[model samples]
Target: MPSTQFSLNIRTQPSREPALPCHETSEQARELVRGTSLELYSDGALHGRTAMVAVEDPLRITVSGLEDIILSRTPGDDEHLIAGHLFSLGLIRTPADILGLAFPDNDPGHAVVRLRTTKPRRSLGPLPGGPRIDPEGIFRLRERFEQRQRLYRSTRATHAAALFKADGELLAYGEDVSRHCAFDKAVGLALENRLLAGVEIAMLTSRLASDLAAKAAMARIPVLCGFSAATSAGMELAERRGITLIGRIGRDSFTIYANGRRLDV
Candidate 1:
Protein backbone atom coordinates (compact mmCIF):
# COMPACT_ATOMS: atom_id res chain seq x y z
CA MET A 1 0.00 0.00 0.00
CA PRO A 2 2.46 2.61 -1.18
CA SER A 3 1.59 5.79 -3.07
CA THR A 4 3.28 6.64 -6.35
CA GLN A 5 2.14 9.40 -8.72
CA PHE A 6 2.94 10.36 -12.30
CA SER A 7 1.84 13.56 -13.95
CA LEU A 8 0.63 13.90 -17.54
CA ASN A 9 0.36 17.43 -18.90
CA ILE A 10 -2.55 17.88 -21.28
CA ARG A 11 -2.60 20.96 -23.44
CA THR A 12 -5.86 22.82 -23.72
CA GLN A 13 -7.08 26.25 -24.67
CA PRO A 14 -6.87 28.92 -21.98
CA SER A 15 -9.93 28.59 -19.80
CA ARG A 16 -11.08 29.42 -16.29
CA GLU A 17 -10.95 25.75 -15.19
CA PRO A 18 -8.18 25.16 -12.69
CA ALA A 19 -5.53 22.67 -13.68
CA LEU A 20 -5.71 19.52 -11.58
CA PRO A 21 -2.94 17.08 -10.82
CA CYS A 22 -3.12 13.74 -12.60
CA HIS A 23 -1.55 10.66 -11.04
CA GLU A 24 -0.93 7.36 -12.77
CA THR A 25 -0.27 4.40 -10.49
CA SER A 26 -0.83 0.69 -10.69
CA GLU A 27 -0.71 -2.39 -8.48
CA GLN A 28 2.32 -4.67 -8.57
CA ALA A 29 0.44 -7.87 -9.19
CA ARG A 30 -0.65 -8.41 -12.81
CA GLU A 31 -1.03 -12.16 -12.87
CA LEU A 32 -4.53 -13.40 -13.50
CA VAL A 33 -4.28 -16.60 -11.52
CA ARG A 34 -3.57 -17.52 -7.91
CA GLY A 35 -1.95 -20.82 -6.98
CA THR A 36 -3.78 -22.90 -4.43
CA SER A 37 -4.03 -26.57 -3.68
CA LEU A 38 -7.29 -28.42 -3.80
CA GLU A 39 -8.28 -31.98 -2.97
CA LEU A 40 -9.80 -33.81 -5.93
CA TYR A 41 -11.44 -37.19 -6.17
CA SER A 42 -10.70 -38.66 -9.55
CA ASP A 43 -10.92 -42.31 -10.71
CA GLY A 44 -12.13 -43.29 -7.24
CA ALA A 45 -8.84 -42.10 -5.72
CA LEU A 46 -8.15 -39.02 -3.61
CA HIS A 47 -5.83 -36.71 -5.46
CA GLY A 48 -4.54 -33.50 -3.86
CA ARG A 49 -3.11 -30.99 -6.31
CA THR A 50 -2.32 -27.37 -6.88
CA ALA A 51 -4.56 -25.31 -9.08
CA MET A 52 -4.49 -21.91 -10.67
CA VAL A 53 -7.71 -19.99 -10.09
CA ALA A 54 -8.79 -16.64 -11.44
CA VAL A 55 -8.13 -13.69 -9.19
CA GLU A 56 -10.84 -11.18 -8.36
CA ASP A 57 -10.69 -7.99 -6.28
CA PRO A 58 -12.71 -4.88 -5.68
CA LEU A 59 -12.02 -1.71 -7.72
CA ARG A 60 -13.65 1.47 -6.54
CA ILE A 61 -14.05 4.34 -9.03
CA THR A 62 -14.82 7.84 -7.79
CA VAL A 63 -15.67 10.47 -10.42
CA SER A 64 -15.51 14.18 -9.72
CA GLY A 65 -16.50 13.68 -6.06
CA LEU A 66 -20.05 12.77 -7.03
CA GLU A 67 -20.72 9.37 -8.60
CA ASP A 68 -18.80 6.22 -7.69
CA ILE A 69 -18.98 2.58 -8.67
CA ILE A 70 -17.26 -0.46 -7.23
CA LEU A 71 -16.35 -3.33 -9.52
CA SER A 72 -14.89 -6.76 -8.91
CA ARG A 73 -12.11 -7.33 -11.41
CA THR A 74 -8.66 -8.74 -11.88
CA PRO A 75 -5.74 -6.55 -10.73
CA GLY A 76 -4.44 -5.03 -13.94
CA ASP A 77 -5.41 -2.17 -16.24
CA ASP A 78 -7.27 -0.51 -13.39
CA GLU A 79 -6.74 2.98 -14.77
CA HIS A 80 -7.99 1.97 -18.17
CA LEU A 81 -10.96 0.23 -16.62
CA ILE A 82 -11.98 3.31 -14.66
CA ALA A 83 -11.57 5.61 -17.64
CA GLY A 84 -13.49 3.30 -19.90
CA HIS A 85 -16.17 2.71 -17.32
CA LEU A 86 -16.78 6.41 -16.94
CA PHE A 87 -16.88 6.88 -20.68
CA SER A 88 -19.20 3.92 -21.13
CA LEU A 89 -21.51 5.25 -18.44
CA GLY A 90 -21.69 8.58 -20.32
CA LEU A 91 -20.01 10.33 -17.42
CA ILE A 92 -17.33 11.86 -19.62
CA ARG A 93 -17.29 12.63 -23.34
CA THR A 94 -13.58 12.34 -23.97
CA PRO A 95 -10.39 11.41 -22.21
CA ALA A 96 -9.52 15.10 -21.88
CA ASP A 97 -12.60 15.53 -19.74
CA ILE A 98 -10.71 13.71 -17.01
CA LEU A 99 -8.47 16.31 -15.42
CA GLY A 100 -6.83 13.92 -13.00
CA LEU A 101 -6.84 10.27 -11.97
CA ALA A 102 -5.38 9.16 -8.65
CA PHE A 103 -4.97 5.73 -7.19
CA PRO A 104 -5.19 5.74 -3.42
CA ASP A 105 -1.85 5.12 -1.73
CA ASN A 106 -3.37 3.17 1.13
CA ASP A 107 -5.58 1.09 -1.15
CA PRO A 108 -4.55 -0.15 -4.56
CA GLY A 109 -8.16 -0.99 -5.35
CA HIS A 110 -9.45 2.56 -5.20
CA ALA A 111 -9.26 5.27 -7.92
CA VAL A 112 -10.39 8.89 -7.95
CA VAL A 113 -11.04 10.73 -11.22
CA ARG A 114 -11.31 14.50 -11.17
CA LEU A 115 -13.22 15.83 -14.13
CA ARG A 116 -12.89 19.21 -15.82
CA THR A 117 -16.63 19.53 -15.71
CA THR A 118 -18.37 19.60 -12.35
CA LYS A 119 -21.45 17.67 -13.53
CA PRO A 120 -21.64 14.42 -15.42
CA ARG A 121 -22.21 14.78 -19.16
CA ARG A 122 -24.89 12.58 -20.61
CA SER A 123 -24.99 11.10 -24.11
CA LEU A 124 -26.84 13.56 -26.31
CA GLY A 125 -28.10 11.26 -29.04
CA PRO A 126 -27.56 8.05 -30.93
CA LEU A 127 -24.13 7.36 -32.32
CA PRO A 128 -23.50 7.92 -36.00
CA GLY A 129 -23.40 4.96 -38.39
CA GLY A 130 -20.21 3.50 -39.79
CA PRO A 131 -19.08 1.68 -42.90
CA ARG A 132 -20.29 -1.80 -43.63
CA ILE A 133 -18.42 -4.75 -42.12
CA ASP A 134 -18.32 -8.04 -43.94
CA PRO A 135 -19.91 -10.98 -42.19
CA GLU A 136 -16.66 -12.87 -42.55
CA GLY A 137 -14.90 -9.94 -40.91
CA ILE A 138 -17.02 -10.39 -37.81
CA PHE A 139 -16.04 -14.05 -37.52
CA ARG A 140 -12.41 -13.19 -38.06
CA LEU A 141 -12.56 -10.65 -35.29
CA ARG A 142 -14.11 -13.19 -32.94
CA GLU A 143 -11.36 -15.69 -33.74
CA ARG A 144 -8.73 -13.10 -32.95
CA PHE A 145 -10.53 -12.14 -29.78
CA GLU A 146 -10.52 -15.77 -28.59
CA GLN A 147 -6.84 -16.12 -29.37
CA ARG A 148 -6.02 -13.09 -27.20
CA GLN A 149 -7.56 -14.47 -24.01
CA ARG A 150 -4.36 -15.47 -22.27
CA LEU A 151 -5.96 -15.40 -18.86
CA TYR A 152 -8.84 -17.60 -19.92
CA ARG A 153 -6.42 -20.05 -21.45
CA SER A 154 -4.55 -20.23 -18.17
CA THR A 155 -7.40 -20.21 -15.65
CA ARG A 156 -10.56 -20.84 -17.73
CA ALA A 157 -12.24 -18.18 -15.60
CA THR A 158 -11.86 -14.99 -17.57
CA HIS A 159 -13.71 -13.06 -20.24
CA ALA A 160 -12.22 -10.91 -22.99
CA ALA A 161 -13.05 -7.90 -25.14
CA ALA A 162 -11.24 -6.88 -28.29
CA LEU A 163 -11.43 -3.71 -30.38
CA PHE A 164 -11.07 -3.84 -34.12
CA LYS A 165 -11.34 -1.45 -37.01
CA ALA A 166 -14.32 -1.72 -39.30
CA ASP A 167 -12.18 -3.68 -41.72
CA GLY A 168 -11.17 -6.13 -38.95
CA GLU A 169 -7.86 -4.67 -37.88
CA LEU A 170 -7.30 -5.52 -34.24
CA LEU A 171 -6.51 -2.52 -32.08
CA ALA A 172 -6.58 -3.54 -28.42
CA TYR A 173 -7.51 -6.52 -26.30
CA GLY A 174 -8.49 -6.72 -22.63
CA GLU A 175 -9.20 -9.67 -20.37
CA ASP A 176 -10.67 -9.75 -16.88
CA VAL A 177 -12.75 -11.76 -14.40
CA SER A 178 -15.88 -10.09 -15.76
CA ARG A 179 -17.02 -9.16 -19.24
CA HIS A 180 -17.79 -5.58 -18.28
CA CYS A 181 -14.34 -4.97 -16.88
CA ALA A 182 -12.67 -6.50 -19.89
CA PHE A 183 -14.65 -4.36 -22.32
CA ASP A 184 -14.05 -1.28 -20.24
CA LYS A 185 -10.31 -1.87 -20.22
CA ALA A 186 -10.20 -2.21 -23.97
CA VAL A 187 -12.24 0.96 -24.49
CA GLY A 188 -10.10 2.75 -21.93
CA LEU A 189 -6.96 1.87 -23.83
CA ALA A 190 -8.45 3.13 -27.05
CA LEU A 191 -9.52 6.37 -25.41
CA GLU A 192 -6.17 6.98 -23.76
CA ASN A 193 -4.27 6.37 -26.98
CA ARG A 194 -6.80 8.15 -29.19
CA LEU A 195 -7.28 4.93 -31.13
CA LEU A 196 -11.03 5.22 -31.46
CA ALA A 197 -10.95 8.02 -33.98
CA GLY A 198 -11.52 5.51 -36.75
CA VAL A 199 -14.62 3.46 -37.32
CA GLU A 200 -14.48 0.63 -34.79
CA ILE A 201 -16.14 -2.54 -33.63
CA ALA A 202 -16.01 -4.49 -30.37
CA MET A 203 -16.18 -8.23 -29.93
CA LEU A 204 -16.68 -10.08 -26.67
CA THR A 205 -16.57 -13.60 -25.28
CA SER A 206 -19.56 -13.10 -23.00
CA ARG A 207 -23.28 -12.76 -23.63
CA LEU A 208 -24.44 -9.43 -25.05
CA ALA A 209 -26.46 -7.59 -22.45
CA SER A 210 -28.33 -4.31 -22.60
CA ASP A 211 -25.83 -2.56 -20.41
CA LEU A 212 -22.94 -3.81 -22.49
CA ALA A 213 -24.56 -2.61 -25.67
CA ALA A 214 -25.17 0.76 -24.07
CA LYS A 215 -21.48 0.95 -23.20
CA ALA A 216 -20.50 0.40 -26.80
CA ALA A 217 -22.88 3.11 -27.88
CA MET A 218 -21.46 5.49 -25.34
CA ALA A 219 -18.03 4.80 -26.75
CA ARG A 220 -19.41 5.58 -30.22
CA ILE A 221 -18.50 2.16 -31.53
CA PRO A 222 -20.74 1.33 -34.47
CA VAL A 223 -20.69 -2.42 -34.25
CA LEU A 224 -20.74 -5.02 -31.47
CA CYS A 225 -20.24 -8.73 -31.98
CA GLY A 226 -20.37 -11.54 -29.43
CA PHE A 227 -19.82 -15.27 -29.47
CA SER A 228 -22.88 -15.83 -27.33
CA ALA A 229 -26.53 -14.86 -27.21
CA ALA A 230 -27.95 -11.37 -26.88
CA THR A 231 -30.69 -10.19 -24.58
CA SER A 232 -33.85 -8.56 -25.90
CA ALA A 233 -32.98 -5.41 -24.06
CA GLY A 234 -29.59 -5.44 -25.68
CA MET A 235 -31.13 -5.57 -29.12
CA GLU A 236 -33.43 -2.70 -28.28
CA LEU A 237 -30.61 -0.56 -27.04
CA ALA A 238 -28.45 -1.32 -30.03
CA GLU A 239 -31.23 -0.46 -32.44
CA ARG A 240 -31.91 2.81 -30.73
CA ARG A 241 -28.25 3.72 -30.69
CA GLY A 242 -27.63 2.80 -34.34
CA ILE A 243 -25.14 0.15 -33.28
CA THR A 244 -25.12 -3.15 -35.07
CA LEU A 245 -25.31 -5.97 -32.51
CA ILE A 246 -24.36 -9.39 -33.75
CA GLY A 247 -24.53 -12.48 -31.54
CA ARG A 248 -24.13 -16.27 -31.71
CA ILE A 249 -21.17 -15.82 -33.99
CA GLY A 250 -20.01 -19.26 -34.92
CA ARG A 251 -17.56 -20.62 -37.45
CA ASP A 252 -20.19 -20.69 -40.19
CA SER A 253 -23.10 -18.64 -38.98
CA PHE A 254 -24.14 -15.57 -36.99
CA THR A 255 -27.21 -13.56 -36.10
CA ILE A 256 -27.58 -9.82 -36.41
CA TYR A 257 -29.95 -8.48 -33.83
CA ALA A 258 -29.87 -4.79 -34.69
CA ASN A 259 -28.72 -2.33 -37.35
CA GLY A 260 -28.12 -4.92 -40.04
CA ARG A 261 -27.37 -2.11 -42.45
CA ARG A 262 -23.89 -1.87 -41.05
CA LEU A 263 -23.02 -5.45 -42.01
CA ASP A 264 -22.76 -7.01 -45.44
CA VAL A 265 -22.96 -10.71 -46.20
Candidate 2:
Protein backbone atom coordinates (compact mmCIF):
# COMPACT_ATOMS: atom_id res chain seq x y z
CA MET A 1 0.00 0.00 0.00
CA PRO A 2 1.23 3.52 -0.84
CA SER A 3 0.06 6.98 0.25
CA THR A 4 0.17 10.22 -1.75
CA GLN A 5 1.45 13.31 0.04
CA PHE A 6 -0.10 16.76 -0.46
CA SER A 7 1.49 20.04 0.54
CA LEU A 8 0.64 23.73 0.50
CA ASN A 9 3.05 26.62 0.36
CA ILE A 10 3.06 30.40 -0.24
CA ARG A 11 5.72 33.07 -0.54
CA THR A 12 5.63 36.65 0.83
CA GLN A 13 7.80 39.73 0.59
CA PRO A 14 10.75 40.21 2.89
CA SER A 15 9.79 40.93 6.49
CA ARG A 16 10.18 44.46 7.79
CA GLU A 17 8.84 46.62 10.56
CA PRO A 18 5.43 47.92 9.47
CA ALA A 19 4.86 51.67 9.67
CA LEU A 20 3.46 53.10 12.89
CA PRO A 21 -0.20 54.08 12.42
CA CYS A 22 0.40 57.50 14.01
CA HIS A 23 1.65 58.75 10.64
CA GLU A 24 0.77 58.12 7.03
CA THR A 25 2.73 55.34 5.32
CA SER A 26 4.48 55.38 1.98
CA GLU A 27 2.97 54.17 -1.29
CA GLN A 28 6.10 52.06 -1.88
CA ALA A 29 4.40 49.23 0.01
CA ARG A 30 2.15 48.60 -3.02
CA GLU A 31 4.02 45.48 -4.07
CA LEU A 32 1.26 42.86 -3.89
CA VAL A 33 2.43 39.82 -5.85
CA ARG A 34 4.89 37.06 -5.14
CA GLY A 35 6.84 34.42 -7.05
CA THR A 36 5.49 31.12 -5.80
CA SER A 37 6.85 27.61 -6.31
CA LEU A 38 3.99 25.28 -7.07
CA GLU A 39 3.06 21.98 -8.69
CA LEU A 40 1.92 22.12 -12.32
CA TYR A 41 -0.31 19.51 -13.90
CA SER A 42 -0.13 19.73 -17.67
CA ASP A 43 -0.49 17.21 -20.50
CA GLY A 44 -0.96 14.38 -18.04
CA ALA A 45 2.36 15.17 -16.39
CA LEU A 46 2.75 16.64 -12.91
CA HIS A 47 5.78 18.85 -12.36
CA GLY A 48 7.04 21.85 -10.40
CA ARG A 49 6.52 25.39 -11.57
CA THR A 50 7.00 28.99 -10.53
CA ALA A 51 4.16 31.46 -10.89
CA MET A 52 2.98 34.84 -9.71
CA VAL A 53 0.32 34.87 -7.02
CA ALA A 54 -1.66 37.72 -5.58
CA VAL A 55 -1.07 38.71 -1.98
CA GLU A 56 -4.27 38.64 0.08
CA ASP A 57 -3.90 40.01 3.59
CA PRO A 58 -6.41 40.27 6.39
CA LEU A 59 -6.92 43.67 8.02
CA ARG A 60 -9.10 43.97 11.10
CA ILE A 61 -10.47 47.49 11.45
CA THR A 62 -11.82 48.57 14.84
CA VAL A 63 -13.27 52.02 15.39
CA SER A 64 -12.68 52.88 19.01
CA GLY A 65 -14.34 49.57 19.93
CA LEU A 66 -17.55 50.89 18.39
CA GLU A 67 -17.49 49.21 14.95
CA ASP A 68 -15.36 46.48 13.41
CA ILE A 69 -14.83 45.05 9.96
CA ILE A 70 -12.23 42.64 8.61
CA LEU A 71 -11.22 43.37 5.06
CA SER A 72 -9.46 40.82 2.88
CA ARG A 73 -7.34 42.97 0.62
CA THR A 74 -3.83 43.67 -0.65
CA PRO A 75 -1.11 44.87 1.75
CA GLY A 76 -0.84 48.64 1.38
CA ASP A 77 -2.60 51.89 2.10
CA ASP A 78 -4.06 50.30 5.17
CA GLU A 79 -5.11 53.57 6.77
CA HIS A 80 -6.90 55.15 3.82
CA LEU A 81 -8.52 51.87 2.93
CA ILE A 82 -10.11 51.56 6.35
CA ALA A 83 -11.25 55.16 6.38
CA GLY A 84 -12.94 54.80 3.03
CA HIS A 85 -14.68 51.62 4.08
CA LEU A 86 -15.93 53.25 7.23
CA PHE A 87 -17.17 56.28 5.35
CA SER A 88 -19.02 54.17 2.80
CA LEU A 89 -20.73 52.39 5.64
CA GLY A 90 -21.83 55.83 6.87
CA LEU A 91 -19.94 55.28 10.08
CA ILE A 92 -17.76 58.37 9.68
CA ARG A 93 -18.41 61.59 7.81
CA THR A 94 -14.89 62.77 6.89
CA PRO A 95 -11.21 62.18 7.56
CA ALA A 96 -11.38 64.52 10.54
CA ASP A 97 -13.68 62.03 12.16
CA ILE A 98 -10.68 59.74 12.49
CA LEU A 99 -8.33 61.12 15.12
CA GLY A 100 -5.65 58.52 14.41
CA LEU A 101 -5.02 54.95 13.17
CA ALA A 102 -2.82 52.34 14.81
CA PHE A 103 -1.70 48.74 14.49
CA PRO A 104 -2.62 46.79 17.61
CA ASP A 105 0.33 45.06 19.26
CA ASN A 106 2.33 46.26 16.22
CA ASP A 107 0.48 43.68 14.17
CA PRO A 108 -0.20 44.77 10.62
CA GLY A 109 -3.30 42.55 10.42
CA HIS A 110 -5.18 44.65 12.98
CA ALA A 111 -5.85 48.41 12.83
CA VAL A 112 -7.69 50.71 15.20
CA VAL A 113 -8.98 54.17 14.36
CA ARG A 114 -9.61 56.55 17.21
CA LEU A 115 -12.74 58.42 16.21
CA ARG A 116 -13.72 61.92 17.17
CA THR A 117 -17.27 61.55 15.82
CA THR A 118 -18.91 58.11 15.80
CA LYS A 119 -22.46 59.13 15.08
CA PRO A 120 -24.74 56.61 13.37
CA ARG A 121 -25.53 57.11 9.72
CA ARG A 122 -28.18 59.63 8.83
CA SER A 123 -30.53 59.44 5.84
CA LEU A 124 -28.78 58.67 2.56
CA GLY A 125 -30.21 61.06 0.02
CA PRO A 126 -29.67 60.99 -3.72
CA LEU A 127 -26.41 62.30 -5.17
CA PRO A 128 -26.12 65.75 -6.72
CA GLY A 129 -26.33 66.68 -10.41
CA GLY A 130 -24.04 68.61 -12.78
CA PRO A 131 -20.29 68.36 -13.44
CA ARG A 132 -20.88 65.98 -16.31
CA ILE A 133 -17.92 64.16 -17.89
CA ASP A 134 -17.05 63.74 -21.52
CA PRO A 135 -16.39 60.34 -23.05
CA GLU A 136 -12.93 61.43 -24.18
CA GLY A 137 -12.02 62.21 -20.61
CA ILE A 138 -13.03 58.68 -19.55
CA PHE A 139 -10.66 57.24 -22.14
CA ARG A 140 -7.81 59.31 -20.79
CA LEU A 141 -8.63 58.28 -17.24
CA ARG A 142 -8.51 54.65 -18.34
CA GLU A 143 -5.07 55.21 -19.80
CA ARG A 144 -3.80 56.56 -16.49
CA PHE A 145 -5.53 53.84 -14.48
CA GLU A 146 -3.99 51.07 -16.57
CA GLN A 147 -0.54 52.51 -16.03
CA ARG A 148 -1.03 52.30 -12.26
CA GLN A 149 -2.07 48.65 -12.13
CA ARG A 150 1.28 47.21 -11.09
CA LEU A 151 -0.09 44.26 -9.15
CA TYR A 152 -2.79 43.27 -11.66
CA ARG A 153 -0.26 43.32 -14.50
CA SER A 154 1.92 40.81 -12.68
CA THR A 155 -0.67 38.56 -11.01
CA ARG A 156 -3.88 39.48 -12.83
CA ALA A 157 -5.63 38.84 -9.56
CA THR A 158 -6.56 42.30 -8.37
CA HIS A 159 -9.24 44.90 -9.12
CA ALA A 160 -8.76 48.67 -9.18
CA ALA A 161 -10.66 51.87 -8.41
CA ALA A 162 -9.81 55.45 -9.26
CA LEU A 163 -11.48 58.75 -8.36
CA PHE A 164 -11.24 61.77 -10.58
CA LYS A 165 -12.53 65.29 -10.83
CA ALA A 166 -15.12 66.32 -13.40
CA ASP A 167 -12.36 67.78 -15.58
CA GLY A 168 -10.35 64.50 -15.65
CA GLU A 169 -7.82 65.29 -12.95
CA LEU A 170 -7.12 62.22 -10.84
CA LEU A 171 -7.84 62.68 -7.16
CA ALA A 172 -6.98 59.25 -5.76
CA TYR A 173 -6.47 55.63 -6.79
CA GLY A 174 -6.49 52.18 -5.18
CA GLU A 175 -5.86 48.60 -6.30
CA ASP A 176 -6.47 45.50 -4.23
CA VAL A 177 -7.40 41.83 -4.29
CA SER A 178 -10.92 42.74 -3.17
CA ARG A 179 -12.98 44.91 -5.47
CA HIS A 180 -14.82 46.53 -2.54
CA CYS A 181 -11.57 47.23 -0.76
CA ALA A 182 -10.11 48.75 -3.91
CA PHE A 183 -13.02 51.16 -4.16
CA ASP A 184 -12.75 51.93 -0.46
CA LYS A 185 -9.06 52.71 -0.76
CA ALA A 186 -9.72 55.18 -3.54
CA VAL A 187 -12.44 56.92 -1.57
CA GLY A 188 -10.28 56.86 1.56
CA LEU A 189 -7.39 58.50 -0.26
CA ALA A 190 -9.75 61.22 -1.42
CA LEU A 191 -11.10 61.62 2.11
CA GLU A 192 -7.63 61.93 3.60
CA ASN A 193 -6.85 64.74 1.16
CA ARG A 194 -10.22 66.42 1.85
CA LEU A 195 -11.14 65.82 -1.77
CA LEU A 196 -14.08 63.55 -1.23
CA ALA A 197 -16.45 66.32 -2.17
CA GLY A 198 -14.49 66.80 -5.38
CA VAL A 199 -14.68 63.22 -6.64
CA GLU A 200 -17.24 63.64 -9.39
CA ILE A 201 -16.41 60.41 -11.19
CA ALA A 202 -14.99 57.00 -10.36
CA MET A 203 -13.92 54.00 -12.44
CA LEU A 204 -13.51 50.43 -11.36
CA THR A 205 -12.45 47.20 -13.03
CA SER A 206 -14.37 43.90 -13.03
CA ARG A 207 -18.11 43.41 -12.64
CA LEU A 208 -20.20 46.26 -11.31
CA ALA A 209 -22.37 45.17 -8.42
CA SER A 210 -24.87 46.65 -6.00
CA ASP A 211 -22.35 47.03 -3.22
CA LEU A 212 -20.26 49.38 -5.34
CA ALA A 213 -23.34 51.34 -6.32
CA ALA A 214 -24.24 51.70 -2.66
CA LYS A 215 -20.75 52.93 -1.83
CA ALA A 216 -20.93 55.49 -4.62
CA ALA A 217 -24.32 56.59 -3.40
CA MET A 218 -23.11 56.93 0.15
CA ALA A 219 -20.04 58.87 -0.97
CA ARG A 220 -22.19 61.00 -3.32
CA ILE A 221 -20.02 60.28 -6.35
CA PRO A 222 -21.91 61.48 -9.42
CA VAL A 223 -20.56 59.15 -12.07
CA LEU A 224 -19.40 55.51 -11.94
CA CYS A 225 -18.04 53.34 -14.72
CA GLY A 226 -17.18 49.67 -14.60
CA PHE A 227 -15.08 47.70 -17.06
CA SER A 228 -17.52 44.83 -17.20
CA ALA A 229 -21.29 44.48 -17.17
CA ALA A 230 -23.40 45.83 -14.36
CA THR A 231 -25.78 43.77 -12.29
CA SER A 232 -29.47 44.63 -12.34
CA ALA A 233 -29.24 45.62 -8.70
CA GLY A 234 -26.35 47.90 -9.52
CA MET A 235 -28.28 49.61 -12.26
CA GLU A 236 -31.25 50.09 -9.97
CA LEU A 237 -29.10 51.58 -7.28
CA ALA A 238 -27.48 53.99 -9.71
CA GLU A 239 -30.85 55.09 -10.99
CA ARG A 240 -32.16 55.65 -7.50
CA ARG A 241 -29.06 57.47 -6.39
CA GLY A 242 -29.02 59.75 -9.47
CA ILE A 243 -25.59 58.42 -10.37
CA THR A 244 -24.61 57.92 -13.97
CA LEU A 245 -23.63 54.27 -14.39
CA ILE A 246 -21.46 53.17 -17.31
CA GLY A 247 -20.66 49.51 -17.70
CA ARG A 248 -18.95 47.15 -20.14
CA ILE A 249 -16.25 49.71 -20.93
CA GLY A 250 -14.36 48.82 -24.08
CA ARG A 251 -11.71 50.34 -26.31
CA ASP A 252 -14.16 52.76 -27.89
CA SER A 253 -17.59 51.89 -26.63
CA PHE A 254 -19.48 51.42 -23.37
CA THR A 255 -23.03 50.99 -22.08
CA ILE A 256 -24.75 53.39 -19.76
CA TYR A 257 -27.19 51.48 -17.64
CA ALA A 258 -28.69 54.39 -15.72
CA ASN A 259 -28.65 58.14 -15.19
CA GLY A 260 -26.92 59.30 -18.39
CA ARG A 261 -27.14 62.94 -17.33
CA ARG A 262 -23.47 62.92 -16.29
CA LEU A 263 -22.40 61.87 -19.79
CA ASP A 264 -22.33 64.17 -22.76
CA VAL A 265 -24.29 61.55 -24.73
Score each candidate by Cα lDDT.
0.78, 0.78
| Shift of residue 151 alpha carbon in model 2, Å | 0.7
Q: Clashing residue pairs, candidate 1?
A: none
- For TM-score, the strongest prediction is 1
- lDDT per residue for candidate 1 within 1-265, as digits (tens), equals 1222223233234444422234555445455577788899999999998877888889888875575789999877777777788787667666778777777784667888787775656765787758778878776777777777777887899899998888778887788899999999898778767786663888998899998998887778888889899999999999898888999999989988998887675
The digit string of per-residue lDDT tens for model 2 on 1-265 reads 1211212111122224222125422223334667788899999999997878887878888776574788898887777788788888787886657666766566667777777767768636787665867887778888888999977887789999999888888999998899999999899878867788888889999687999998988888889998999999999988888889998888888898998877775
Clashes of each: 0, 0
TM-score of each: 0.86, 0.84
